[model samples]
Structure formats: C-alpha cells, structure tokens
Target chain A: MKLTKFAMAAALLTSIAFTSCKPKDSEIKANVEAALKADMKMANTVVDVNDGKVTLSGECTDAECKAKCESTAAGVKGVKTPVINNLTVAAPVITTPPPASTATVLDAATQQKVKDGLKDINGVTVDFTADKAVIKGTVTPANRMKIMQILASAKVQSDVSGLMDKK
Target chain B: MALQDKYAQLLSAAQTHGVENLSVAEQNGVLHVSGTAKSTADYDALWALYGQIDPNMASGDLMMNIDVKAAAGAQLKVTTDSTNLNIRSTPSTEGEVVGKAAHDEVVTLVEKTDDSWWKVRTAQGEEGYAYAQYLSPM
Candidate 1:
C-alpha cells in the first residue's frame, strides 16, 4: 500500500513540473516588447507573443528588413519561434495641403464689410475672390473713396476703369 | 525692448505650436534662438518671421537653430486592435497607402508630423506616415 501511494505522488509531481516549465503568455509578451523597444530599426513594428511563438507585423522597407525584425524578436528570451506576415516593402506616402496664402488668411467679416460698402454703387459689384478684391462696373468718386477705405487692408484690383481719374 | 525681446512674438508662436526644447538668449547684439519644431510648417513659419523681422536676412545677428522633431530614430511599437494599420505617403486618409504595419510590429519612428501623423521607418527602410493614435512610443 505504501508503494502504491508513493507511485501516485510521483505521477502528480511529474505533471506539475511540465506545467511550470513554460513561461506564461503575459511574461513572454513583456519581454518581447522590451527587446524590440531597444532597437531603433524595429521602431515601427509591433510584437505579440502566444505560447512562446511571436508574431511581428508592420511595415518593413524590404524583405531583408522583415527577416531582421523576425530574427530580433526570435532572439528575445522566452520566445520560441517568430512568425512574420504581411510586412510590406514600400515607402509611406505623404500628401499635405498647400500652404495657406495671405489672401486666404483674411477673415470673412472683413470681406463682408468690403462687399457691403460697395453695394449702393450702381452696376458695381465688389467681390473678393482668388486673393483679390475685385471691383466690377462703375463707381462715383465718393463711393470709390468709401470702397478704398473699407478695403484698406486688402490689395484692391479693379475691373471697372475711369472710376478714379485725376481730373 | 532688447534684441532678444524683439523676438518675443516668434517665441510665443513657437511655444504655442508645440516646439520643444526652446531656448532664447541674447549676447553681443545677437539673438540666439533654438527649438525643435514639430512640423515643416512650423519650422517655415519661424524662418519666415525671422525674415520679416530682418529683411533679406541682412542683419545676420539672429542665430536661430530650429530643428524639426521627427521620429526618424525613435523605437515605436504598433498597437492596432486587429486590422492592420495603413501607412500612407501623406498624413491624410486620402493619401495613397504605400505600406502596412501589422498589429504589434516594432518600427522606428522617423518623425511626428504635427500631432496627427507620425512618420515611421520600417526595418527595411520603408518610410511613411501612420496614424499617431496607433503608435506607442518606447
């Protein structure tokens, strides 16, 4: 009976040893993260570990770089195998809007003021477009002076001629 | 106001734009300004202001060193929920996608363009912009 109990105890200890031998999944992930962070070349890559197998995914400039990243992750402690997938070897595209010109910076309130001041002028329409204060049709001398005053801060361009002739 | 104090407006603008490591000093009629601009736009604005203050750079008294802060050599890990993060040439979604980063990949940060886009260089030297939200600095 003593021998039978001893055999059962030995079997239980053997099972416990096998279970404790492998590192937990969380612990493996932490180590992989730390290892990858130390390397500048692996900056854009992400690391995930599951049951000691690591999967690296992100943009890679080339196939060789991807291999390097895989190897780096594999070298980390507690990682048994490195799996690489969908690593691309292409450059990132950067498309930015053109810089805003000085004309665009002018506020709408100021533009409206210029338009309101020129409303009473006969056959004359004042519009601010394409960075210019456009004055169309004709204006009296007094109205022209008012337009100038309202658009004092803007660059005035006139389509209508003979509005301000020195006579 | 002193010569350095004359640049207070520019300094204030730079700080508001998130320029890092800002330093301003005046000595021998020279204003030495140094800071790290977050984007090329901010960098250009600083120089443009400098030009306006001193036309044609004639004075040569202002020594300004405004460096663009890029993630060029920074180590960053990818953090996507499941779908791969798109790496585009431009910062906007309309930008053409040149590459992709799988979830949990470690990549080098080339630069952070503004706060929205991060320029990252992959191990293969592939460089592009990724959404700043997905990249975790290490």
Candidate 2:
C-alpha cells in the first residue's frame, strides 16, 4: 500500500511539472503579441500561435522589417524554433516629380512678341541682345508692373537696370 | 538653392494659395516660377509678396510667369488704365484695330490666343483679339 501511494504521489508531481514546463498556446500567443507590440515597425504584423508554433503574417515595409519580425517572434519564450514568416514586403512607392521649368530662349519671334506686348505701355523701350531684352526709360509703378508682366508672358529675360521709377 | 531660400516665402505662399501646376526652377542665376493662380486676387497677392521680398522687383533674379485662371467663355474685365483696350484683327499690334473695350468694361473671352493676346468679345457683339494684360478675369 505504501509503495502504491508513493507511486500515485510521484505521478501527480510529474503531471504538475509537465504543466509548468509548457505554457498554453493562448499564453504563448499573448506573450509573442506583447513582444511584437513593443516595436512600432511590427505594429502591422499579425501574430498567431498554435501548439507553441508562431506564424507571422502581414505586410512589412521592407525585407529588413520582415527578418526582424521573424527573429523577434523566435526569441519569445515558449515559441517554437523557426517562426513562420509569411509577411510580404510591400512594393516600393514610385513618385514622378513635376516637370522642371526650362530656360526660355530669346529668339527673334519671341523678341517680337515682347515688342508687341510693350507697344501698349508707354515710355518703355526694349533692345534685344543675344540673350535678354535691355529695357530703358521712366515708367510709373503700374506701367513697370505691366512691363515686367509683358516680359514674363513672352518669357523674355530683361535688364531693367536702366529703368527708372517715375515720380 | 540660394535663390530658392531667398524666395522661400513666396514659394510657400504660392503653395498655400493653391496655385495649380506650380513649377519652380533655378537656372543661370535666375529662379523661374510658373503657375496658374486660382483667382485674380491670389495673383495680385503673389505679385505684392514678390515686390515685398525684392524691393521694386529690381533684382532681376526671379522671373515669375504666373497667370490667373481664366477659361474660354469666362467674363473678363478690361483693366486698361483709363483708356479703351483696342481689339485687333490679329494677335499683334500690326493687326488692324477691330473694336474697343473701355476701361473696366466687362467682356467675354472667346479664346486664349497666346500668353500676350486673347480673343475676346464685347457686349456690342464685336469679337477680336485683345491684349491679355489689359483683360482681367472677373
């Protein structure tokens, strides 16, 4: 009888030991999720634990993020080795920049457009050089704005240094 | 980027005012800014900011080619300085004067002939090309 009682006690102790050694799958999942939540990059990752095996699934921004997630799940306590990394790396975003403004060439036709624009504004005269229009004469502030607007519309560069502010 | 830094306020304002198709570039010591402002008030405000940044706009370091948004059939006001805006047979001064739009007179835009000229029609049913600078979209 003593021997039988001793065997029963040993059996109960062994069962308790086994229960303490392996955490429940739900407990493993909670622990792994907590570990992943500590990292902002892992926020989007989905953590699933089944029989101590961890499966990570979701979109990672890059390969580095995916690898880090796998390592992170593997390091969690009670997690099985070789965490399943089903995380997909998202495709890189491509943004086409707006077109850059090009330099305006002062050709004869363009210079003529500048001249035609200046015809209505009095007191301003233009001389076309190799690259830019050389503007001279006294102009009221309003007319000065008009002259500049005209030159800009025609895309003609100008040396307005000779222009004087009309009092 | 020095020119860009110098004109950062103006550039930021352009963005804030919702200038469409805004393009900014620096070349040969000059900064070229091109865009279409949403309204005439916004265009004037930008010009005012430009003048404030560069006194008298005499630096010649910036060439801003901003146009106000005006579509065909939009009403335009003749903005001439107390004189009648001459409508011409063609887009240039060489064209014969076809009609006249008085200062502050409202007219309808037929087409944008070019940057410097637009085809406009007055209330009197006369239609021809007029200098775009003298016509402001209402």
Candidate 3:
C-alpha cells in the first residue's frame, strides 16, 4: 500500500513541475494583448502565443512604431525572448498641391520695380513680357540669388532660361 | 506636387525654424514660398539648404522670398562685400548719395521705405535711405 501511495505522489509532483515550467499559451496571449493595448498605434496589432513564444503581426505607421510593438510584446511576463515581429510599415501618403493659377501679367510699374532692383547688379538685364520677366545675363551665384529675391519681392514672375552662370 | 516633394526638406525646415506668416503656393509651374525668418542666420541657413538641394538653384522651379524679421529702430549690420553702403536721399538709385556707412557698421533702421530700400541712421547721426539688400538685421 505504501508503495502505491509513493507512486501516486511522484506522478502528481511531475505534473506540477511540467505545468510550472511552461505558462498556458492562452494566458500568455492575453497578457501580451493587455500590454500592447497601452499604445493606440498597437490597436491593430494581433498577438499570438504558442508554447510561450509571441508573434506580433499588424500594420504599423512607421519602422519606429513597428519596433515599439515588438518590444512591448517581448516585455510580457510569460512571453519568450525574440518575439516575432511581422509588422509592416504602411505606405506614405502623397498629397497633391492645388491647381496652378492663370498666367500673371506684369504691369509697367512692376517691370520698373524689377529694373530698379537690378541696377546695382552689373552684367544683368531684364525685359518684361506679358506675364514674366525674361532675364538674359551672366551672374554670379550670389547675384543670381539676389535677382530671384528681388523678382519675388516685386511679386513678378521670371523666365531666367536665358540667364547664364558667370564663370 | 513634384516640386513640393523636391523641396520638402526646405519647407520642413521653414516650419521647424518658426517662419512667421509662411505662405506656399504653386502657380504657372513655379513654387513661390514667402515668409519672415526669425533671424538673419535662419534666412541664410535656409538659403544654404536651398543651394544644397538644388545646385546653384539652377532648376528655377522654386522662388524663396524669405525676409528677415526686423522692426523700426532695429539694429542692422552693413553686409556689403567690403564696400561702403551708400546712403541715398531717396529710395531709388536715382536718388542722391547723402552719406556712407562703412562695411560692418551697425546702423539703426529708420523705416522700411519699400522692399528694396530702407531709411537708416548711422552712429554719427547721418540718416538716409540704403539698399535693403546690403543691410542685415542684427
């Protein structure tokens, strides 16, 4: 009778040891899900636990967000190390600019403004057409910037295609 | 939009640097950006970034009309390339030269007569209009 009791005790101890060694997969999944819930970005992330290993799969806004989700999963108490990160970075959104306005006309006053602005910079000449100033001259990079700034300040459009870089 | 993407970093920097009254528009296939930079350093940095993005700004697709912030009575430094800034009696080159502010001289802004000219006064009490291009806000 004593021998049978000893055998039963050994069997119970072995079962307890196995249960303590590995947490239930369902419990681990719930824990990881709870941890990931802290971040709104992780709301779409799906958590799966199998044999204490956690696998996170979802779409993250960016690489940084994806890595954050993986780390969060790995930090769960029952989760195994090196959590599988199958998150994908969503494609960036492209926005279109507003439509172009009709061609602008440069009045004589505006043209004279451009002329007055360019008087200081030598080797440059400007001719005002219907809508834009057609400039043709060789100008240093500094002078080129100055011309552009001056034209902008005058609110006049320019066609500098004829302008050449000063050597 | 392509032009906007090409100049994305520049626009982003403008926002990061706190450019006031910033306005960006695309018209006639040209990108026009205008704003007031907080300082001359910010304006120069933006220009340098522009040159870096577009070598010598040859594309001619972007028109950056950034102005440095300054008020009446603000201190301005003469930024001419080692030349005395001619203070004129009027806002135009046709105006008579009244006084001269040496290179690197700090002058007080009297008024922004226009985009291309400003009325300024020197330490020696000489007051006249100077080309706005050669005066940088200190």
Poorest stretch of ten by lDDT in candidate 3 chain B: B56-65
| TM-score quality measure for candidate 3 | 0.61
Tens-digit per-residue lDDT, B1-138, candidate 1: 477677778878888988998877665465666676777568657767765765434343555655556556877777555567778888666579898888888888877774446799887677898765456665
lDDT of each: 0.63, 0.88, 0.84
Residue B99 deviation, candidate 3, in Å? 1.8
Model 1 local distance difference test score? 0.63
Q: Give the runs in model 1 whose Cα sits over 4 Å from its true position.
A: A1-13, A61-64, A86-90, A94-167, B1-138
- Name the docking class for model 2: acceptable
Interface RMSD of 2: 1.3
- Per-residue C-alpha lDDT of model 2 across residues A1-167, encoded as one tens digit per residue: 99999999999999989878899888988888888888898887998888889999999999999999999889988999999999999999999865434566777778878888777778888898887889999988888888888888887777889999998
Could you tell me how far off, in angstroms, the CA of residue A121 lies in candidate 3 after the best superposition? 1.8
The order by descending DockQ is 2, 3, 1
Clashing pairs in 2: none
Chain A TM-scores, per candidate, are 0.42, 0.49, 0.51
Judging by DockQ against the true structure, name the best candidate: 2
Which 10-residue span in candidate 2 chain B carries the lowest summed lDDT?
B51-60
- Candidate 3 C-alpha lDDT tens digits along B20-104: 9888988767888888999999988898899899876667677787889999999999977667888989877778999999999
